[model samples]
Target: RKPKTLLAGVSGRARPGRVLAIMGPSGSGKTTLLNSLAAQMDKAPGLVLQGEVYVNGEICNQSMASMRKGYVRQEDTFYSQMTVRETLRFVARLKLSPEVPYEDKMAVVESLIKKFSLAKCADTIIG
Candidate 1:
């Protein structure tokens, strides 16, 4: 039996300084397409993913691609009791370079909160 294809014949380009949004109904292969583009799709048994993903016009291979891309799922998972600020802070601490100073990390977090207009709920529980 052949495995089902989660994505088919999808193609596009994302240029620098330009924002791209993927919108579709549930189960419409939106996540699948993003995962394929980011090269983060799960390697499940009997699953085969085909097609090429390119970055800056270069093919995005394991060694050639920098793992700096971020993917936020439709259903975000975080500590329900932790405030948004705390959640962002924790993620920054974990994902940011160790050489990045504490103040710089905090500054980045603050910038992100402001940029995303998250200040209204920065101290509210993520849930």
Candidate 2:
């Protein structure tokens, strides 16, 4: 059985200080592409993924093993007792470079909250 191709001939680059989005209609492989790029795609029967993904110009396969990547699903899940800010902070600490200063990490978390308009419920717990 051959699994249908979710993505084909897709190539692009995401550089520092720039934001790139993978947008398309539903069932258009946006999530597949992101999972492949992050090397976090689930290994499913008959699902063959063949492509090259590069991060910072390094091949994903070669570097993903040692790299720390983050993937936020469309439906995010978090501890019901933790506030949004707390959840973000926890993820930032775990995913961000160890050398990144605490203040800088907090800054990034704050920026994300603002960018996503989560400020209104930043302190709300997930339920």
What TM-score would candidate 1 get against the native?
0.59
> Considering summed lDDT, which 10 consecutive residues are worst modelled in model 1?
39-48
Deviating ranges (above 4 Å) for candidate 2 = 43-46, 56-58, 79-123
List clash counts for every candidate, in order.
0, 0
What's the lDDT for residue 9 in model 1?
Answer: 74
Inter-residue clash pairs, candidate 1: none
Total backbone clashes of candidate 1, pairs 3 or more residues apart or in separate chains: 0
Please write out the lDDT profile of model 2 over residues 55-125, one tens digit for every residue. 66766666465576556777656878999999999999999999999999999999999999999999998
lDDT of 1 by residue, 3-113 (tens): 687877777876666778998899898877876766656733555677677777777788755666666766666989999999999999999999999999999999999
CA lDDT, candidate 1, residue 71: 67
User: What are the models' TM-scores?
Assistant: 0.59, 0.54
Off by over 4 Å in 1: 43-46, 85-124
The alpha-carbon deviation from the true structure for residue 16 of candidate 2, after best TM-score superposition, in angstroms, is 0.4
